[model samples]
Structure formats: C-alpha cells, structure tokens
Target: MPGQPSAYHPGPRPTTPRRHDVIILGSGIAGSTLGAILAKQGVSVLLLDGGVHPRFAVGESTTHYTLKLFRLLARRYGVPELEPLTSYVGYRDQIAPTSGTKRHFGFIRHEEGQEPDPAEFLQFSPPSKGLQTSHLFRQDSDAYLLHTAIRHGCDVRQGIPVENVELEEDYVAVIDKNGDRYEGRYLVDASGFRSPVADHLALRKPPKDLKHHSRSMFTHMVGVRPTDECLRVGPEDAPPIPWVEGTMHHLFERGWFWSIPFNNTPDSRNPLISVGLTLDERLYPKPDDNNPEAEFREFAARFPAVERLFKEARTVRPWVSAGRIQYASSQTVGHRWCLMSHAGGFIDPLYSRGLANTAELINSLVWRILDALAEDDFDEERFRYVEELQQGLIRYNDELVNCSFISFTDHALWNAVYRIWCAAEVPINLRFDRFTERFLESGDDRVLREMEKTAYPGLPVPGSHGYKALFDEMVRLCEAVDRGERAAADAGKDLMTTVQNSPVVLEHLGIRDPNRRFVYPKPEDLRRMAHWLRHEGPRELSYLTTGVGVHGRPLPSALDEELAVPH
Candidate 1:
C-alpha cells in the first residue's frame, strides 16, 4: 500500500553513549553499501533507516555500465559479495534466486487505438553474455545488501526514525524520535527524497531546473503475458533477443509503461511482476478521483496491446502514485555531511540509470571519504567534486529523459533519437569499462580523478572532439524539438544526415546500412568495436571529423568570443 508502514522490529536499545567514525542516515542499498565498504576497511560506521527491509521499493532495473561499475567496486574494494550481483549467472549463483535475467532492453511504440508497427519496435542487446544484467527484485536486493553491510561489521539499526541531525565542526549528532542521541565524526544522508538531513539543512533546490517532469503509478502484480507472444510479430521480424527475456517498455505519445518480470526462471518462486506507468504530467494530468489502481487501468486501456497484456494480471499490492519524481538539492555536501546521489536528486527512470549512478557515486565517494579521513579534513570544499559529479549526472539524465519525451510524440524523431542515444551509450560504456580495468591494474586514485575530468554529462568519459561535437548537435536538435521549435520530420532528416556523415557513431553502433537504420550487431562485432576504440579511436579523431557538418564552419564573432576550452 502507498503509505502503509511495515511492522516495526525493535532491536536492542542503545543505552551507553558511543561515537563512530561515520554515522549514516538510512540503511537503504546506498547507505548500507557505503557502510559495508567503509566498515570492511576497519572504519567504525553506523547505518540507520526508518523503514524495515523486505519492504516495497522501485528502481528495479540494471544495465551493462552498472554491472561494470559493480565489478570494479568489488574488485577495487575487496567486497566479493558485490561482485556476484554484477551479472545474470553470478547473481543467480550467489545472490537471490528470485531475480530475472535481462538479456536485452526492448521498446515498442504504440498509437492510441492501434497495435504497434513492428517496424517501429526497437531492441538493444548488450555486447556479450557475460555483461547481461538483471531485473533486481529490490526488496531482496536491499535486504541482501543490508545483511552484507552487517556482516562487514557495520552497526545497523532498523525502525529507528531519525528526528534531527546536528552537524558540528568535528562531529555530527543524530537525535531519534525517542530523543536518544548518536554521534560520529561525519554524517552521510542516504535516505531517499524525504531526507531529514537535506530538509533540516535547507539544501533543496527548485525541481523546475530539471528539464524532465513526470509522475508515476506503480505496483507489483501477477500474470503479465509475455510481450513477444502478445505482440505476435512474425519470426523474421522478431528481435534477435526475445523481448520477454528482459525489461520491456511500451512507449506512447504522452507516457511509457514498464513491464519487468521477476519469475523468468523455472526455479524462481516469486511470480510477481513490477509494472509502472510514467506520464508526462504536463501532457497527461492526473485524475481527480485519486485512485491509483483505477487510474492505472484507465490509462493502460488507451493502448490495445498494453490492455491485452494486462488482461489477466492482478495486482498483489496497492498501487502507489507520485505527483512529480524530479527533484534537486541546492547543496549535496556541507561542513561535516553529504547526501547520496539519490538522496541529493533524481531525474527519472527512463534509461535505468538510477542503479548505475548510485553505484558510481558510492565508488567515487568511498575513496574521497577515506582520503578526507586520512587528512583529518571534513570540509565541504574538499568534496565539491562529488557535488559536481552528482549534479552533472542529474543534468544529463534530465536532458536525456526530457528529449526522449519529445521523441515519443513522433516515430521519425523516436528512431533518430534512439539511434543517437545508442551511439552515445555504447562508446560511453566501453570507455568506462576500459577505464575501470586500467584503474584496477594500477591502484592510482589519480586515474579516477583524471577520468572524472572527461565526464561530459552522459558519456562515461570525455570522448573525442568529433564525438562531443556530434552529441552536442544532437542535443541542440532534440532540445529544439522538445520546445516545439522544430518539426519531427525535419529533425529526423537532419539527424540522419549527421549519422550518415559521422563514422564514429555509425561504426561504434555497427549501423552499416543507413537505409535499414536498425541493426543488431553480433557479439563478435561489438568486441571488435571495443578493441578499436581503445587502441585506434583516439588517434583518428581528426580524420573522423574531416567531413562532419560542423567541421570548419566559420563561427559567429560573438560565439567565438564566448568559446574557450578550460585548462
């Protein structure tokens, strides 16, 4: 149920005064994972969460980049338990058995009353089988991580509602509802949206700064039909990977529907499927009835295919809805405290970047915090880079999701924008994978700082000049479409021209035929693409930009005056 609280499990009461190296707010995966890492390093850490584990939660998807980051973190920090959750095979063997394997990501565009066109369907498969991710059963995942943290010697207390947090020059004091006080050298907030630390510190920023605006209604259900079976596309037209074998998205003009299966395996006991409807509130306003399940059914019925898929599904829990899922913080770090990536801000779930962002932030912050502790400094200025990284990720997600909403309104724009997204996504993942591998080989923290410098909003690393220029142009065109300043057809044509002329995007994406436009490369092809990117891609940037549309174009004098590359 939406606001129903779980049964509070009162653990041992705290009587004696104690001080730890760090006091963490919230025992969610982010907080627990960070605590476990620090505790494993012999640091005294305490994690507190208002809600109990095995409770309902969302953000249930993962990606290749997420897997890579997890593996890197585990290997770098000596947390073998986390390495298991990085892949489908490992997750099943080591983690919970209730999770689902995500071999590919599938999307289908639908009209109001008509079945979706097979030609408009898009499926994105990861490069290799080892890199295949999973649809995380967050309840199980969170509980497992909490146990992992406890096993690592982190002092954890559940059902402890935090009342106030006091930040001092040398330590932080946390007061609970019962007026009990806990103190530690540093405070970290990992509680999602309702962050007591952020609220008390007055660090929240206006959500209007985000380009994306959305509301969601979601719940766990049973009996969702397989997407491929429901769609009934011809064998020849079917995706190389089965649509039902991964997280499926049913996209429409004003919104999108997510169908994530949790019982894809035969041994799986959980039959529940996590389903959600996200609507652009500006285009589709909520009904006044205030019934989430009813509103979900009414909205799902608008598309015939979605209606059929959910015909036999029955909700196992009450549906939950939110007014707006976008939020930001004016500051993510203070004199003696900081907010987790999610605790600071969240844009949307359009690309399943939540987990990836969370893992990446934890990885970076862990090292920074250790460094700060070694130097006996907890100044906010020391952690400003963490703030930049978090805000930069939110800005990137905002642009991606907001522009994606515009693409959904027109098939032509969708096709072009989807390609552009893939182009940006592939190389970015490849770069991060390589960067992590290198950092693992050489334990130099500077490698990470240098890698962070290359961070251009979305891509994992700062790519070639040609790649940046191409992506920037695409963003400009998409932003124009988002604002209704450009027609979809015209933008599509321009995007196609850009794709046709740019070999970096085309070759990286394995888009050999511009006419066919949709190509699913073999695993071997992707492997070769990664190899080329690491060895020869950087040296060829000048040649790659030779025939680009923006290349050699005379810039306006005012624009030239404003353009200066940072040192």
Candidate 2:
C-alpha cells in the first residue's frame, strides 16, 4: 500500500527549522531520487520544491537500460511490485490504430553530427519483454518517484519556492518565498536550471553550451488519433497508450515530431498526443514562448517539413513548449556550498537522456550530502565523488551525442571521427557505470540499506573491458566508416553483433546466465558469410541462417531486449 501521505497533517508549519542534515531544492527527478537515497540513509533531509504532486511534464523517452532503473525504484519504495507496471498494456492499449506502435523494439536513430542515423533506433518493436514496460513514463513516473522518496523518509515540502540562503559557519539556512527558514548542514542544488540555491550562492557563472543536438517544443492534446499517413513514417505506429516518438526528419529533413499518450483521467479531458518540432537552431530560429504561435508560424513558413506536420494536424488544448536543450554546468560545485544541479540545469533531450540523468544525479548527490552530514562534518571527499558522478554523466552524453553525430554524417571519414570521440568518452563511461556504485561506495551504509530496502536492482551492465572495447571500436569504426572500406560500412552493426554474441552480452541481456556460461554465435564464426551481411536490414539480421538465406529458426525472442544493450 502507498504510504499514508493522504493523512491530513495540521496547517501552520514551523517558520524556521534549527537544523537538518541537508537541504534539497527542486522536486523533479533528481531532487526526488536524491531525497529518497538520503532519507533511506537515515539522514534528516529537507526537500523543497516549486510544484505539487503528479504535475504535468514532457520528457518520456528512455533507452533499453531504463527498465532496470525503474524496477529498482519500485522495489525500494513500498509501492506495489513493479511487475504489473513493467508489463502494463496501457502503452499498446491506447485507442489508436493497431499499427500505431512505434519503437516496438527500442529505437536509436543515431546521427553522428546533425545527420540522420537510421539504425540508431533499436532493432524493432517489442525488442524484449521488459522493454515494452519502459514505455509508461511522463504520466506515472513523478508520483512513483515522489512516494519512493517519502518512503525513504525525505522531508519533502512541495509548492514552496525558496527565496534566499545563508551559509553559516555550522549550517546553511534557507528562506522560502514567504520568508520562513529551514537550516541544514549541507545545501544540494538538485534545483533544476531554475535553481534558487545556486542563484542564492551564486554558484553558477555563465553556462557553456556543449555539443548541442537540437531543440523541441511540445503541447498536450486529446482525441488526436494516429493516421495511416503517420504510420508509414518512422517511429510511429499507433497512438501508443504510453509513448510514441516520430522522427519526421528521418522521413523528411530538419523536421522531427513525437506523440506520447497517457490515460485521460483526473486533469485531462482526453488522451493527449505530445506534438513537437525538433530542429537545429542553425537551420531555424528558436520558438518564443512570448509568442509561441507566431514563432511556430515563422518556423512553418521557413521549414517546409515542419509546416506540413502541423499544418493539417489539430492540436488540442493545454499547448506547451520546451527547448531541445544541451549545456554544461558553469560550476556545479564550489567551496562552502555546492550545486547538485539536476535535470533542468543540464543538457536537453537528444537521446532521451534527461530524466534518467536527473534521477541518477539526485540519488547520488543526496546520499553524499547525507553521509557528509552524518560525519558531523561536510565530507569534501564525498562531494568530490558527486562531482565525478556528474562529470561522468556529462561524458556519457558527450559520447552518445557524438555517436549520433558520426552515425548521422555517413561520410567516409565518419568512422575516424566516431572512433576518436569514443576514445575520449570511455573513461567517463567506466566511472559512471551505475547508481548502485554511487550508493554503495558511501562510507555510511544507512542510505545504501534504504536503497536495498527499496528494491532497486543492480543494472546488470557490462564491465570496464567491454566499455573500453566499445569506445576503442567506436573510434576504430569511425575511422573505418571514413575509409569507406568494404568491411567497414556499418562497423557499429558488426560491433554490436559481436558484443551481443559475447558471454557478457548474453548475461546482461538475460539471454543466458553467467554461472551457466553458455557460448553464443561469435562474429568471427559468422564472418564467413559477410557477403550477405552487406545488404541486410535489422529484420534480416534477426535470423541465424546459413549463407544467402540458408534456413534457420527465428532468433531468440529475448534477443530484442537482451542483446541490443546500450553502451
């Protein structure tokens, strides 16, 4: 059963709290996740946010690995078991056409540098069992996250905007919008880009934009059903009850759109479709909320593809807009006070990375701050670890972005470009492997035990060597991609195939257990038939046939989820 947050606690809360272990501002993914981690650690945490529960939000995409994370959160909290959520049919059950399923398998349209990378979307729809379970984001994720944090004992106070913070010798005191104060040993800026703590402490200087991907503006709708014209395009099948991403750019250039659906209950009048326009700023001007309709008109006039997508479509009410953003923290951490700078402050949604990064960062930082407070002193070393965690995250995005960049280029030289970029991002990958590493490494096991209590599972991911090979091969493949060699056309595909065939891949993908140690069909073993691989699609590669369509049983159903592991 959910915790009794339904209890009507009395009004007239205290004005100034003397002290707590830590103070977190922002209740989005990062703040909530970190709050949960810290609370479970037995640390007294104060989390203040600007919004109420189950508020409207936009981002919903997740890679193949997100299922494990969500499962972990569910188990940790006292919520019902995650199995139902995982196998929930809401996404496929939306009231759209039958063929309206998109990303049936996970999709990864990788573009190296602003170019279309078709194969980047994962192999096909329904990639694996738990794969479809990940589709229910945006709608249920927030409440799921908030309750989890509360279960961990986070002192979450919502709808209170923080106004000022004073860093004292022993503790930092924060003033809310109405001048009430709360004090704590450490201050965490899980506050998204709309950070009051960072602003109060002046932790941020000018932010430097990293390798930006593109921008997006979205709005909610109801009764906007999917059509056949939408289906034949990329990344859309029917109105997915959970979520749908449409890469209009793959079908057209510089034009991208997506549709995410949810149950129409409570707040909404009808099922909504999140229609969007994602494009490079270099090509079209940014949309202005000051006059979004006018800004959109300007874009439609200038960009033909975007015009066509929105021209005929009827967008329902509750129109919302968001920037497809990317950027690096100016100084996420400083001397006395540091910013746990969660989602809103970092880069935008290119590979659907924002929410995962947000939750992970929060969980990591809150644990660190809690540990530092437990010691009766601020553990600078733990904060340093927090810094490393965020840096590692940024590096992962860098690699992912560059992977899309090179994949999109499709230039003969792209292989080299990709390889070199991968070389750089590998170490970060090794360091930022999982949230478990962050929770377990803390000297104080209190937070960790709480995490364990919550049922967060370890993401059965690859080890360092697999990561190193991936990075090295990425560079090598980029170089290979550049050479335009016969054997190098789609080196990414070959590498993925080889890795999937590896013992570790089988284990990570849940194909075969490591203890049992069953060997897979090796890339080298299949090299004899490279001639046919030259002209095959993901569907063709889904088989285990002999040369030139030699008949074989269909590939394992698990291959969709298990083998197509994201780096």
Candidate 3:
C-alpha cells in the first residue's frame, strides 16, 4: 500500500505440502471480511496479508448502510449486540468549489464572478458542498473489525505477503514473499489497492478510470475539536463526527475536507477526533513537496477555521496515510477466476460509498463461493449471477458517484433543476432508498424497474415532468434575470410557483396516467416459479425464474463440473 495498490512477483512456492479449502490474499477489510465469512461457513480458510491493518489509511466516513451489513454479520456470527467501536455522529465534508460548479452550469460562488459551464462541472465535480467532520476512521473502527474477524473462525496470517496464485488443475496454489507454498481448492483475490493475484494471474489489470481532476492526501490528527470554545465560537457539531457535520466542509474554495469523530483513549474521561482534508492538486498545491508535512501545516495555518481544528487537534500517535482516491480496475472476473478487490478500486469515495460497495461484494460473492464448496460443485449459474450482479452494482455506483460529482455546470439553472426534481414530491417517483430496498427484496425484476425508474424519472415517474418542464422554464428565467426582465427575486418566485403547481403541471407533462401501481416482482407466484426452476439443475428453467445465474451463458465449468479434488 506504500506504493499504490498493485502487484509484485511473489516468487515461487516452497514446494511443501500445505492444504486448505480457500486461500485469501491481503488482510485489509475486504480480505479479512471474506476470510471470516468463509471460516464461519465451516470452511478452512488460510488468510494471507502482507502486513497488519491499521496501517496508514484514510477514507473513513462510512454511510448509514454500512452499519446494516455490520448488524447482519454480527447476527450471523452470534454477536447479537455489537455497538460501533467507531461511529460517525454525523458525516461532514469540507465545503469547497467543485469543478461542476465552475465548468458545467453557471454558478454564483458565495464570493463573486464564478460561473462554470456544465462540461467542467462534470469533469471535476464534487458533492454539493456542506458539513465538516465524519466519524469513519476513528481507530476504534479498525480495531473493532480486526477483533470481530478474530472472534469469528478466521485463520489470519499477518506479515505473510502473498505474491500470486498458480491456477492449477484442481487446487489453486499460493506463493508468498518467502517462497512458502499453500494451496486451497479456491483462491480469493481480496488484495486491496494492490491486486497481487489479479495482476499475477492476468485476471485483471488496474484501470486509470480517473480524469484530469484526481489528487488525494490525508492524515488523521487527534484533538480535532475545540476544547477552549463552546458553541459561541466553535462549530455546531462536535469533532470526531463525519462529513455531515457543520461548516466543516462547506467553507472551502477547492476540494472537500473530512474531520471524523473518534474515541479518545482506552483509559479516560474524553474522546478524540480524526481530521482529514482531501484537496485536489488543482487548488491545494504540493508546490514544494520537499517537505509536504511542513507544507500542509503551513497551508492549514493560512485558513483560520481549518487551522483552528489542527492547532487544537491531537495526533493519534504514528499517524498513517496512503493514496486512496484513484480509478479502480474496471474488470473483476473472467471465466475461471474472480477478484475480491475493494478499497476504492472501481469507484470513488465521494458519498462514502467505498465501504458500502465493499460490503455488497462480500455479501454477494462470499456466499456463492461457500455454497459452491459446500455442494462440492461451484454453482456456475450462481457464479455468473453474482458476477453480473457485481457488474450492475458497479455500474450503478459509478452513475451515482459520477452524477453527484459531475460538473455542477447546470447547478444554477439546468443542473439545479435536475437534482432538485429528485427532491420534489412526484406522484410516483421512486426515491433512491426505494430502489435499494426493492433490489434487496427481489433481485432481477426489482433491479430492472429501478433501472427504468432512475434512467428516465420524468417520463418514468407518474407526476414528475411538470417539475422537469419547470426547469426548462427556469433556464429561460435565468436569461431574463440576467437581462433584468424581472428581478432575481422573480426567478426565485417562479421556482416556488413551479413547486406549488407541480402536480397539475406534471399532469400536463404526462404524470396523470392515474394507474401508478407497483411495477416489480409479482408476489409469491414468481418465487414458486423460481423454486421449480432451481431443482431442474443447470438445464432447468428453474434458475431462470430465480435470477440466480447468467441469463445467456451456460453454467461455469467449475460450478457445473464434478467435485473438486484436494491437491
């Protein structure tokens, strides 16, 4: 990780006889999570990692959804009451100028003379600005997860760096830095930013999925809160929280900042805060990288508010760091192999999606692998299904991330209207939460409906278009306001008018069909249909009904073939 996540030749296996059901590489969250899950299934999992976790790392602010998975995992592992060892009281972001605000739509920076076109906004977009601290990486979190992994039945091997895997006739063999050989029936590439197995086996390559606007640097400091001031002069929220906190992120001209809440100490009457600021190279410079640490301290000194947090903040002893904000390898799996690569490899961390996406991969892929080994036959159908599911999830997340950060070119006029319409109360608008819920309850039909719904909400939603047309009118109003037709007040008034008249107006734009019923998974009948297909085996139409495998491809040989022999 000191180097960006990549591969290194692990040399050769020591040619000793070692065996296990599964071989895992990397001990970061993704790999550890996988090891624990498999071990719980009563499978023998040999988890390998180059070094220990709690290494210099960032990208803390986790979303509400992450807790849900933790809850589920805890329940399954018999830890009924697991509190967040590390929790974000709220999320925070460093308020700053996003490329979208400058490039895509015209914007009135709270300052002045800042009008950005849409294209630039899309290229270098950041989430709409707001907040300060997030409670994502409060040391307790890393410790908690490692503890949980150990609590489960995982066999963790730290400082045992895995170089690559030899996809063998039966079992997959692992070779480490010191020429140790171990083989497992299955190989899981949970290697983080550095995907050793993926790189070695040529299963996938890292993709430069980023554009002109990507630079990230972060370090955690304790005492990020103000001990000297109360609400009178300090921020409204306590430090040790996440991006949803107060003006923490809302007061910047360049990239976003994150100050997370963390526990103080194992012994004592206080808690500490973890502060992180992510600035793009475009604005925050590394002009004199000769001493980046001194430069950062000097930079923080320039911004009084930012400086206050640092000056008062505590360093959690041996603060750590690594570059996390970058593109992920676009491809994950092939016919005979797959990857468990998480850690912002295929996505961005703007919405605190890194962890949530990681959970998604584990929840989907881990089980299929377990069931495969259990049945002594890898369910090729299930593998393909999970594979596609992973792809779909990636594509969906890419959209959300890209859409949220895309140049705010249309922010004032066009962009603002599009995003705001989502906030509007349309007759049958499917909110994002609704889409996620449906996806969980039932996989395929629900997913398709979500696709159509999110794809074209105005046409897709029953009573949303009046709002859509209202935005087109808004652009016209923007031109008028610029020309002094009415006041900026008049344009603001129009926005309200549209809001008030939305239902009727949307009817004109095609919202009044009057028959907005649920459009997915037609009840138990389909499930019974799926049950029938499941028993039919690979040739059965049963799998079709369940949405459990790839639609067009045959079941994978690993899944459809005979029992795997031990090496």
Candidate 4:
C-alpha cells in the first residue's frame, strides 16, 4: 500500500493544458496547506510535485508557535480540519497514529571520547501544562495536507517534474518534462533549494553571503535507542522528564545530532526514529565515498554516549548528504511570480525554525494573495511586504544560527547564548497564543492583522523595546567572542548578567539562573509572572498579561487572591 493514493487524492492527471488562478510548485506541507485554503475560498489552484506521497522527508519537529498559527489559519479560513493539528490529543485522535509527542526540547552537550556530563544537559518545556508539541511524521502529514487540498478542489499533479517557467507580464507558463504546458495568472515556487522559478529568473545571490556554514546527512532508522539508556548519571541527576519523551539534540563542538522518535508513545505503531547529523563543513569536510550513513557512523563514534545510543540502529532509507545547507535568494517576489519560504531561503535546523518560519509566512501571505486575486492585480509591488519580511527572516536566522555555531566551541558560551534564544522565543510565543485567543473569542480578523503591522519586521515581538535592546547587546557580546576580542567565559558571564538584569525576563521562570537546567513553570510560577507584569514589571511587557493569564487564557477569578500573596 506504499505510495498508494488516498481517498482524497484527485485521480488521473489530465493530458490537456489548463489554466488556473494560481500555480504552486511543491505539494509539501506549506504549498498543499496554502492550496487547500485558496481552493476552499473558490480559487482554482494547480498543485504540482516531482514525487509522490508517503515518501521520506525531514523538518519533522513542531513548536507551540507553529500549532498556534495552524489554529489561526483554520479559524480565519473556515477550515476546521486544521484545528486537530494544534494539540497532541487532537492529533492522535483525529490525525495519523505514527507521529510522536514532544513535551519538551531536550539538549545534552558532549565532549569527544568522554561521557556526557550530567550538568551539561538542559530541558525546557511549554509554559504550562497541556500545551503539547509534536515530532511530525512528515510523510503522513504531507500526504494528509495534500489530500485536504484535493478535497477542497485543487487540481494536483504528482511525479511530474517542472522543466521550465516563463514569467510574462500578466501570467506565468510552466512546462513539464513530457512537453505539457500549464498556465496560471500567478506562480508560486515552493519547490525548495533547486527552485525552478528562482533558477529561471537567476534570483539566487551569487557566492551566498550566509553567515552560517554547515552540511547535513539524514535518514530514517530502526532500533535507535533513547539517550536515557546510555546515561551513566544516577536518578537524582536524571533529567526531570524521560529523555525519550521529546526531541533530543546531542551537541558537540561545531556540530550536533538530532534524534526524533516516532515510537515514543505506548500506543504508537511506528518503530522508526528520524536521525540526522549536522556538521560544520569547515571542520568535517566531505568524504571520498560520499556515503552518508557511513559518515554518520564515523561522526557518532567520536562520542562514547552517541556511539552506545546508535550501536543497534540500522537505517531503513537511503541517506541524503547535503553540502552547505544554507541558501538565500536575491529576490523572493517578482512580476507574476513569488517564491515560498524554503524556496526563498533556508538556514540550519539548529532551533527548529523551519516550520515556524513557514507558518509565519503563510499567515501574512495568504490574505494579501486572496485580495490580489480578487482585484486581478499581480503587480510585484503588491507583495512588497512579503518580500521584505521573507528577506528579514533569512537575515535574522542566518545571524542567530551563525552565532550559535560559534558558541558551540564552548559549553559556557553555548549555555549563555541559549538564554538569549529563550528570551526571544518565550515572549513571542506568548503573544502568538494571545492573538489566537482574541481571534477565537471575538471572531475578528483584525486581531490577527495586528501581527502584520509590526515596527520590527522579522524579530518576534514588533514593539517590545525591552527584549529588543537586550537582544542587541547579547548579539554584540557574541560577535566579540566570535572575533576573539572576548573570552568565552567572560562573554558567557556578560550574557547571563544581561539576562539577569533585563526587565523582560520573568525571574520566576528561572531563565536567568545558570544553575537551573530545566524550566517548567508551575501555576504558582505563572501567578508570580502575572503579578510582576501587572504591578512590578516594565510597561513594555505589561500588555502580555492584559486579558490573558500566563497561559494565554482568562485568569481564574479565584487566582487574584493567590496573585496577591508572595511566593
């Protein structure tokens, strides 16, 4: 039954040339999700892919922000199906059974030929209970979204590689390998790194100026054991949660390895683990044989803990070796055509930002696209903001990941830099949850549009001056360390001091405490955060507690008494 078409698949590719309102390249999650929304709104969409579904793919992690965006999209577009993807319980009951639960982000730092120190690990969970993340089974998730698009009347073509794209003044023409021609009033290239639209237009920036430099080798495997099985630490030193309960990142100097299990839950039927190793290309150059599985094994052998974890594992799919995973396009939007997120640019998967970035782009893009379609206006100027936001995302992510790779050389620096990541991620994710809450309560699209009119283009919170100032200073210190002007230890101390003094960081969360390895906020912690924001915190972040509790819901009336008491 592998590669078989589902009931929602549109059967039989049409031989005749056809015209559509929008022609999308790549039927992966982003493209297919967009296609489904547009088609549901009565627009004709043509979705094309070079391969069929139930295939191996990566980008298998999700975050709270990603799920929040999905809920917003589902609500705003009247597509209730997307709601199921927003939570673990809903996903297991309504979606596929093969995906895994991600209750936290687990990171364990290691040194070559040494047992990983218990103190070197850190685990950060959702702000509150019941906020469940996921390790997506991309093969099934993609196929499901593609099916949704087809059910919404999107004409789809699979296993048909696009040969060429001709972008004219008013419409775009696509040529297939079999000499079939298709036309559309607008074109969108989500085809990823080897984008046909980007290639035809020569939109790639020559000698890519990306600051991050890394290569990756990835594949699916069986018998990949959990990190808990290999740890030498006792129960008292054990991580707060089981290591198998979330996405595990085994990091070393200048590189890292990811293990995402699909069989984490008791009821899960799948037995595969999505494994990948990303290395700084400058440190570990390409091998002669170019066999990725062999390369991965060699890299894992350097660390005793990593070696034990993978000793019994065997790959079930062909390995993909990528040289320099960073890429950027000179232009993201042009006359009668535009490139999707991955097509526009991509950085390393260090922080799992790929899917989150894609979700952000779609939330801002789809509405403008719908408006343009109604007016029959395909001017390049109409999508100017999309272009700006897309470019800014690439620039910001490049710097973030570039700095992270530099920090990997020293654990103290890596630990300090990670707090900076939390500073940006936590507040922004809280705001996103707030946005979803308001939209769901009032059914007002303006609540969502507020996300688009930001003073900061690519940064998480648009108007929060407190966090932005701290972030800028942190980057300066990190850059100094990278340039050999500052000692890693000194820079790490400075970074922690900055976090400790910043008004934006909630002290109750213990983010400023270097000794605290895990951050799982309890109800009392949330109450303290709310009280501080309401009474003691700076005005810049006071808005975070306006109508919602720390959990992005209305505060229980009884909690007022608890908020008044000191913890």
lDDT of each: 0.76, 0.46, 0.44, 0.81
| Number of the top-ranking candidate, with TM-score as the measure | 4
Residues 191-308 of candidate 2 have per-residue lDDT tens digits of 6666775566554434344544566566655444433232234644222322233312222233444544443223233344555556656555664444555565555444343343
lDDT of 4 by residue, 1-567 (tens): 221111122224345538887899999988998899888877789998898997777889888778877877897887887877787777777877888988788889889899998887888875533447888888988888888999999999999999999999888889999999999888889889989998998888854588778999999999999989988889987776798998999998889999999899986778999999998898889987898888899889999999999999999988899888888999999877889989999988888888888878887778777767777777889888889889888887887787777888777888877877776666786666566666666565666777677666776555677777876876788789878999988888888888888888876877888888887666688777777877998887776666553335674332243344431
How accurate locally is residue 160 in candidate 3, as Cα lDDT from 0 to 100?
83
What are the runs in model 1 whose C-alpha is more than 4 Å off? 1-17, 455-464, 506-508, 511-519, 527-567
Q: Which candidate comes out best when scored by lDDT?
A: 4
Tens-digit lDDT string for candidate 3 (42-117):
6676777787766645545544345454544444333432333112222111111110001011111111222212
Distance from true location, Cα of 14 in model 1, Å = 14
At residue 319, give the lDDT of candidate 4. Answer: 87
> What local lDDT score does residue 455 receive in model 3, on the 0 to 100 scale?
24
| Residue 377, candidate 2: alpha-carbon lDDT | 55
lDDT of 1 by residue, 1-567 (tens): 221112222234345435677888888778988998888877778898888988888888898788878887787677888887887767777777888878777889999888898888888764543566888888888888889999998888899999998988888999988898889878899999999988998888877777888999999999999898788567877877777788898999858999999887775677989999998998888888879888888877988889988988999988999898899998888888999878999987887889889888887788778766666778888787788888878777777677778778887777776766677565566456445544544555555556666535434334556666666676888888877899977887787688667656636445533344335665455545545554655563322222211223432321111113110
Q: What lDDT score goes with residue 197 in model 2?
A: 58
Worst-scoring 10-residue span by lDDT in model 2: 510-519
